[model samples]
Target: MLVLPAVVAALSIIFAVLTVGINFNLIHSIFIRKSLNKSKSLTLFYLRFVIDGFLGLQNAIMSTFILLKFLEVEYDEPVEFLFWISWTSMNCFNVRGILVIVISLDRTLAVFMPISYHNFRRRIRNFYLAIIPLSWPIVNNIVLWGVCQFRVNIPPGCVIFTCQMNQCYISYALSFEVVSHAIIALTSLILAVKLFIWNHCTQKGPKSRDLERANYLALIDTLIIIIFDIVPAGFTVKFPALSAQFGSLILVCKMSGYALESWLVRRALKRTNDIVSVSYANNSSMIKSTGQASSNHRHHRHINNHAWQ
Candidate 1:
């Protein structure tokens, strides 16, 4: 009975640690590595990774608590501490979904209208745009906290946050997750088709190839989101009893997904850097060769003129 939950809790903590490490590295790469920061899309991805790192830490702590409970180990914490965790968790969850939607839309625009997308990106400040999505989480949690304060009571001796404490907030959050994921799924499919057609019909160049690679990475991200997030949310809603039994496993899966995403982004950035380096080397060689040829031509011309004189 407790065996499965204990195993899952252990795995969740392990994965959470891995996820946090990967996210931290990715954030550092984006900040310190100029090559990785070239793309505007990565700005949003940077924010996502930051949120993911925080969630990973939270998941680790939560999983430890769950594991202790399964082992019948007694521990105590202030109710306020648990409440803040729950509140922050809710905000992070909602904010992550919104970021996914925004990223998907950004990819779609870049694919369909490359010139316009470039112009738009240049004109608008991504940092300011980011504030819009970031604000949603705070506003949402505040409202939910207010409602819980007045209308709902935190059950005594609650070990962790559960949806039963506030079904209204849970329902709204789940709905948002479902709808946003649906949009992401549809957009990813469309981008896949468009990329396929463009690849076959149009001439492939460095820019086009880079775009394709980035979009494919985004598609992989969508798959991760659908598998870890949407599936678990659906299971929780449709099979609450079963979901409760394996909640720790679901958290582990989510942490695994986040880790995978961070690793993929890092890999893609490295590949892009290699391509840029190679292209730069080739261009430098060509320029050097051209300069040598021009210099030789001028030398020969000067000799010929002197001989004619």
Candidate 2:
């Protein structure tokens, strides 16, 4: 009993912090400093990053409340808000995953239809605009949950062997979660394979080497994320429904995944810096050589002209 509440509380905190660090602390405040930035800035990234940022903030706020409840930090839950937040958080997360799925789809399209992808690339703003309406159904469900305060009656007060963590409800949520995850995993896997084949068969240039490295990085990232998120989230509340100490194992896993993603992103960015530096060095040397050649040519021309005169 003590452990379950604490575990829930801790996950609430972890995810809440993830929401803040990823969105407000980094993307919104530090990154989104441009007025009309579109798809270029890490903030925009074809509008994908910014949208994730927005969703992150919402997730963070919702997570904070859940953590607060677990702490028994009473804010007078009308039962309605609990229902709203519970469903909203889950749904919004799903929507966020969809955004990532779209990014995967975009990458696939880039590979399969390079010319057509470029044509639509400029209108990423439209892509973001389109995702907004798609979230309404999720939002509506949350609102309805709140309005109804539909709390599951599980031995009243505190949950025991009795649980609001009901099987049927869990099944419904898992069915949806697994299906979405499966779709994402399937699509990304196929794309990765196809990408590998193309990379193998195609040119072996410098750009291609960087691409191959990025592919390996991306593959690692996809697998890590898929493992963490393939939820029967009730699983969080059910199986290892162990104490926070026990959940520590899973917590470490989550942190490792986050760290890995961070490392991969930095590695990806580092390659860009290295390329830029090398390009600059090459350009500098070229300019210097050209200047020396010009000076020598001019000097020779003057001497020859003097001699001729």
- Where is model 1 more than 4 Å wrong at Cα? 33-37, 115-121, 147-157, 203-210, 296-309
lDDT of each: 0.77, 0.52
Candidate 2: 10-residue stretch with minimal lDDT: 35-44
* lDDT: worst 10-residue window of model 1: 148-157
Please give, for residues 1-309, the per-residue lDDT of candidate 2 as tens digits.
345655654664565456345534334433465322122323223243344345445444544554555556756544444444445545555564565565555556666776787588756764474465356456445543454344555342332211334454455555665676676687779878888777688836555434344345445546766866553243555666443334333333443444445445545555655676688899999999999999999999999999999
Instruction: Provide the TM-score for each candidate, comma-separated.
Output: 0.86, 0.65
Model 2 lDDT, residue 30, Cα: 31
Flag regions of model 2 displaced more than 4 Å: 1-8, 11-15, 22-48, 51-88, 115-173, 205-221, 231-263
| Predicted candidate 1 versus true structure: per-residue lDDT over 259-280, tens digit per residue | 8887887788788778878988
Give the number of the best model, judged by lDDT: 1
